[model samples]
Target chain A: MTAVADAGLDLRQIEQFLYREARYADEHDYDAWEALWTDDALYWVPAGDDAADPRSQVSVIYDNRNRIATRLKQLRTGKRYSQSPPSNLRRVISNVEILGTEGSDTVVGANFVLVESRTRGMEIWAGRVTYKLRVVDGEIRLAYKKVSLVNKDQPLPTLAFLI
Target chain B: MDCVTATVPQAGTDRPDYSALIQPERVHGSLYTDPRIFAEELERIWYRTWVYVGHESEVPQPGDYVRKNIGPQDLVMTRDREGQVHLLVNRCAHRANLVCEDERGNSNSFRCPYHGWTFRNNGELLGYPYHQGYGGRGKLNLGMATVPRVESYRGFVFGSFAEDGPTLTEHLGAAAGEIDRLCRLSPEGEVELNAGWLKHRTRANWKLLAENETDGYHPQFVHGSIFSVTGSPIGALYSEKSTAVTRDLGNGHSENDLRPEFRRHGEPMRWFGTTPDRVPDYVAKMRQAYGDEAEQILVEGAPHVMIFPNLFIAEIQVFVIQPLSVDECVQHSTAVQLKGAPELNRRMISQSIGSVGPAGMLLADDTEMYERNQVGAEQLRPEWLEIRRGMHRERVDERGLRVGTATDETGMRGFWSHYKTLMEDDK
Candidate 1:
């Protein structure tokens, strides 16, 4: 719970932002969740962990701003039967660390365990997430985010909803 | 010598009558849920037939190899010292422990983790830690067992356990033409599958996924949401009035050939709905190589065809279905990489990322339907799943191929009949 004096951001404020962002995703609030991203937003969930180059290898979900909007648009359609009946979702975020910064962006890392309940069954997903946050207009905006699942190397079930 | 022909069952042996279970217009539901039938299919079809291994491009240089499975068998496809590729059982000759553990790598010999026994990439017994223990080795000559027949067509490799059964070409039969059509897309007449596989697992029979791969009848209904949102012209290709037709390529191989519909538009790169201006270099190279046929190749695009028990060239991706058990199956797929056309490959990669895997806009919806379908198939009331759609309109073409409308059950009939032929052969 140490405050980050270098980036001029405290631990409480950053943790609050992360929790709110997660809550938006958990509630399927596509508009609010999507608005958190900057115009240069990069949302990635790399396949088989976050080591390989995305240009040569493949990914589960790799959206660079425009693709992110298209993904949200598809979810908003309601016709996305995979999420027609959204899964009941909840998550616990922990182990937040400030891993330094790049330019105005603050590089932060955290771990989470999400639970999704649906007609198929209850699914528990554990992953490590890295986020690059930048303050624009005195508000925190997500510049880059990547989720690395423990089982990213293995066969996965349908992940139609936002991670 | 005819692999397609059915062999008679010898007298006094207990053999299930597959004909009664697989009818002309419908199939019994028990075939999906029966554990006994699943076991039989492993022995009769998967293990004995020509199962797809991996593409040669995957193991381009000597010592490069990839791990794969043909049914329940554990295998390693290795490129040996002589630049020859061999499909070897991953077990060590001495202890039966796996020799190759990596999903893919470059190795000239694999040493067993359990014992010190080593094997050459070509399945030869190299040596062990102590040779004198079991009588000093003159030459054990008893290397790891190899798959009986390994063959390749246009760099696509396939392996067979049965040495006496159908040759790979004989098994491919009419399906080979579609493969040629796919390869001809490359200016060098080649396709590389270097992109790693994305696997999607479901609690359903493998046959169900195989049936749905080329099942044009269900896309409009199963994937309507995607069509509604994307408004892709490929959606129209699946409609009833579209010129595209389904073909029964025999030996259970079939296609929802959308060439005629794309050709009707007379547009270049219409498959991806992109113009020549966007991909001037790809179009230019393709034009220079094939001349007049380039237009047809551009429009025809990737094939939506399923090759018998395990393989599929599902438009932008290549799929291999692996049946885990009666109620479990996993599908492995990779985006098609058109060699020498970096521009086209890049687009296919991003387009495919959104289109098929577990999180795909298209496949995710279909997967939900498949899971729901599996739950329904478990119900006891309905003993049969009907395949009688468009039966009256289906007719045999001049080439003795059964042709039907885009949304017919003709492809399914082709699959099950050959399934019956294989299951009934008893030998």
Candidate 2:
């Protein structure tokens, strides 16, 4: 594990990157959001209250880079009925912290509360996010992003937009 | 209690008769609305018929249990110390308070939180705080009342509140063959619900789910987005006139057979032998397990089977509808995986989640349509909802089952026919 001092990555820059990533998702900026991921990026939203291995248990979203691209393409086509009109989303990212380093990747943790408004109603989605970020050409790229929703175990309404 | 024996509708009122509401070719919208009809259904249909409770694998050991509901009645499916599974009413025998509240757990006994009343997992009254309170009581029997009949077929447990109706086998009828086919797909001829379940609350009548399970007519239209996005060949396969068949599997059960070739698209293995790299080991394992029957058992698609009121075995997924009210229901969707095939089970779980999870590509569309149907049903102008899509074209098979084309409403007619008989039995 590399210490924060040894990694020499600016905390403010990392937070700014996180905020920008979230803003792009909230605005449904698919291209910009897709550009932020590494070629082998993993996007996971585990089912139930606790996270489990995606291979062993069911997950709300467990997409590899290719699957993520396919999902984005579906959304781009405007044919996904769940998000036909797209969700009006705004998120508050807080409690950002650097959780040391794994290999060449910098692990980051943060808390988020996303509000999604659609035709049915507005839903308050709160969850914790963990990101494995790697530096590509001096720019932060996401290697893995996992979202653990607070009400994952409960019956959830349609989550059409990206979390 | 007299509500059960009340006339279908008051003589002078404008309410439509129950008989006219459910006819051979059509059904009235009030069947999906009308609190009176809903209550009658809870008693006559849900209570009398075989309702799927839980799978045997859910309680793999003694003391394991899961709470389930039949219509509005709460019950617990528990395995007793003697290894016998029991479906007991969750209410405490002492004061009618619920005995078990947790969704699932392994517990030797359930002790009521309100009072100190304790009962064995099998629903037998173990002890109370003060047993001598009523001078040994007046015919005191505090055991949790078990549903009249509890039975299982091929590890699928079902319970009926009515004591003298059909046995589970008689109730399942032709549906039992579907269950057998599902179990036979497993290399070891067994399946488990261990891959966790996803529950979604739908703002639609419970029957909408039953109708949607095998209704091959709406997939192309309702799930148009999915078909366009995933490029699934299901739309084409279903549209290939004579290739697919919809049959009214006797005793209210119905099925839509989209042919074995339909499994080529989106399933683990395609018919053209282009297997994904991730599941090669799993495919090899299946081949080793089933030998020559691997292609048929592993690759041949399973028909969409709806077992009467509640259970739906949709290929790799098993969906159970728990009706909360006339307008509300909870769908418990579980992925069925082979007992001995771990990697293949993982692939199955992934596919199930991708298509049926709360945020799934397919189910999300279906949910929206179901809610829309409920909203549309509120308009009383259209009194009857038609189920006569292929009424004239329906052909009787050698076994006396009604068979129709893929996009036919023969399955819906079969369901309504059986439902009408049960609701009107009155005896």
lDDT of candidate 2 over B283-386, digit per residue (tens): 67667887887766555545479998899998888998988889888888878877776766777787777778667778877887777788787676546688
List the pairs of residues colliding in candidate 2: none
Please give the TM-score of chain B in predicted model 2: 0.91
Clashing pairs in 1: none
Candidates' lDDT values, in order?
0.84, 0.81
Q: Which ten residues in a row have the lowest lDDT in candidate 1 chain B?
A: B1-10
- lDDT (Cα, tens digit) per residue for candidate 1, span B304-346: 8899889999877898888889888878888888889999887
DockQ of each: 0.62, 0.52
Give per-model TM-scores. 0.95, 0.90
After superposition, the stretches of candidate 1 with alpha carbons farther than 4 Å from their true spots are A1-7, B1-15
Cα lDDT of model 2 by residue, A128-154, tens digit: 999998887767888999999998887
Q: What lDDT is obtained when candidate 2 is compared to the true structure? A: 0.81
In order, the interface RMSDs are 1.3, 1.6
